[model samples]
Target: MSNRRDVWITGIGLVSSLGEGPEAHMQALSSGTAPVVDATGFAPYVVHPLAPISFDAQIPKKGDQRQMEPWQRIGTYAAGLALDSAGIKGNKDILGTTDMVVAAGGGERDQSVDGAILTEIESQPNPEIFLNEQLQSNLRPTLFLAQLSNLLAGNISIVHGVTGSSRTFMGEESSGTDAVRIGWSRIAAGTSEIALVGGAYNAERRDMLLLFALKRLAMHAPWAPVLAQPRGVPTGSAGAFLVLESPEHATARGAKPIAKLSGVWSERAQRNEPGAVEAVIEALINQARGDVTEGTAILSAASGAPEPTAAEVAVLARSGLPVRSITDRVGHGLEAQMPVALAIAALAVSQGSLFAPLEGEPLEKPFTETLSRAIVTGVGHWRGEGVALVERAD
Candidate 1:
């Protein structure tokens, strides 16, 4: 343990339907505010869409904004905010050395091209030949590769100057979980001094809605809280990025850390069994290597999806700690869900206060004691589960 480096959360950049920055989120959470859900736009499928933001503020270059997809722009913009929050924005010296691990889904699909192919394919005499022909003629060069998830990291590097080694993970909620896990591992192991880790999601797209709808996962909303929902609920549009650094590195730069990231654990649970996820979560919490006490709290990335959320709720029930599920406020962010939860958890611990529960679930108790520790958790709709623990800054 003596050889382990201390990992500190020095900066956080978060943007969602709730608002921008940690302060905005803090104010909203503290006030037990109503979430912004767009029921009419996507209809049947509800979305906690992003509020308006001046892209010019962060991604000032119009060309950069034009080339990147909405998710990429949101990510790049958030990366800038993280750098700024850490007092390293525009500092070429520090930015040049900062590594980044991003969790991202593939780029936006070409709906027009897709629709055209779909409409014309059935009319073709030879479906196979026509399909090939359409792919060759309709799809632009580099379109396939451009949609690769890594491009988000590339754009962040190009626009933000975070040019050190980069990696991108792509498996929904687990992707966000591992991005932070790897970033923390590197810094903790002394392989890297400082790193940026997080993800972004633009859930306002039709493609995503259709993707979820195929599995009957899309929520048609009059919009109620996650616990109140009969099943899973709305997805959200969000971007979350964090600047994590070794304690010595942060201290040398005179950057005051907001929180300490003590540990992270991730796992895949077989959904076929009744309580498999609950068992997995129990093990993950046990792996966190600390005691659950009076000052501890849980920030749940509870996907309002019934099967998993219900299991998660059961586990939280026995813990006796205050639980605040962000789903009701920010909605389920899919890939960005866990990252958003972690960012908010860091903010809550840093401020030493618990946010009022948005949904007011029966089991979610109010804590009067200042929060010193937190359990940030994620239960993926289909497969993964992860938990990370953080402590208030000393």
Candidate 2:
């Protein structure tokens, strides 16, 4: 829309249970080995089928860890990987020459912890005396400060010394894509030369999964029994970042461009709007000149279940591009949704291939036929707010 300036992905950083590096992640996705495991890091939190992640013990000890929530760590760590991948080492001189942005969402605390706290309060002696008026109320301010969403952006900037234009969002699954939009805008507008854009989420809590199951939004695909739920958000943890810059800027600096940020389009779905989903699909195709008529493939956002997957299928059926689902293997990491999704999109663009979800044998259904140049769709339940998104192949 803004003269269509050329933008390229020069770097990518990912920290997921599947494996930290790009090649390793790609291998895991291809092999169908889901990094998701039952919650063990915080076993005291629950007993159920959870997507667990083995934390890197090598992470340095800092006072921030004492106060920062797990998601902040994920954000900082993920940002570091993207900077390392981009070859940007926090130099003021370098950042001064580029603009940057951080995209994220799910600032809401998973209410599942409230039940556990209430249980703990029950065991207190003279529970009424200690908990009646409100110990939690007194501690609310401290807890609120610890989980502020902007803290993630602040942590990332501190890690990488990115003193440039910054942007943050809270659109859950669409957060990363929206962040990319900001980065693309900065470079195209000549405000900055390069930008770091992505998302992160720390959802290892069992209550997070239980909450989604309550909403019937949890993974309920007939085949993904382990991840199935009747409602609420699926629990997941992931951090990823992408280095974006104008094609001319990257080439001038001799950066190996991974993929071009070609086109992006989104449409918000209304409550029970019959054609709301298709409306977003049409918007994407129209933006891409009626399906990038010459585009190669599509990267789908469906998270390996029937309802969301079926919704994506119908959208792609209209777009006329092959649709592929990455979540079947990546697991559902919410806010980290597009950061991981777009990062994989960059990889496939460079390799000239589209990746597919791993075979579940009993439950996995292949979307390979439709995922060649696919449309990635994500359905989120942060209270009736859902989104549809599409990204083009390089």
Q: Please give each candidate's TM-score.
A: 0.95, 0.78
Identify the runs in model 2 with alpha carbons over 4 angstroms from their true place: 32-61, 96-98, 106-117, 120-129, 132-138, 142-147, 220-234, 289-295, 303-309, 360-375, 379-394
Best-matching candidate per lDDT: 1
> What are the per-residue Cα lDDT tens digits for candidate 1 across 1-394?
5688889999999999988888888888898778888999988878999988888899989999999889888888888888889998988888889999999987787778888889988899999999788768886555545356888899888888898889899888999999999999999999999999999999889988998888888888778677655375589989999999998899898999989998888899989988999999977876663656868888888888888888888888777778888777898887788889999999999888888765447766778899999898889988899999999778
lDDT of model 2, residue 244: 83
The C-alpha lDDT values of all candidates are: 0.86, 0.59
In angstroms, give how far residue 208 of model 1 lies from its true place: 1.3
TM-score of 2: 0.78
Candidate 1: count of backbone clashes, pairs at least 3 residues apart or interchain = 1
| Model 2 agreement with the true structure over 88-121: per-residue lDDT tens digits | 7666776665555666654445354556557778
Candidate 2: how large is its RMSD? 5.0
Residue 343 lDDT (model 1): 91
Q: How many backbone clashes does candidate 2 have?
A: 29
Residue 22 C-alpha lDDT in model 2: 82
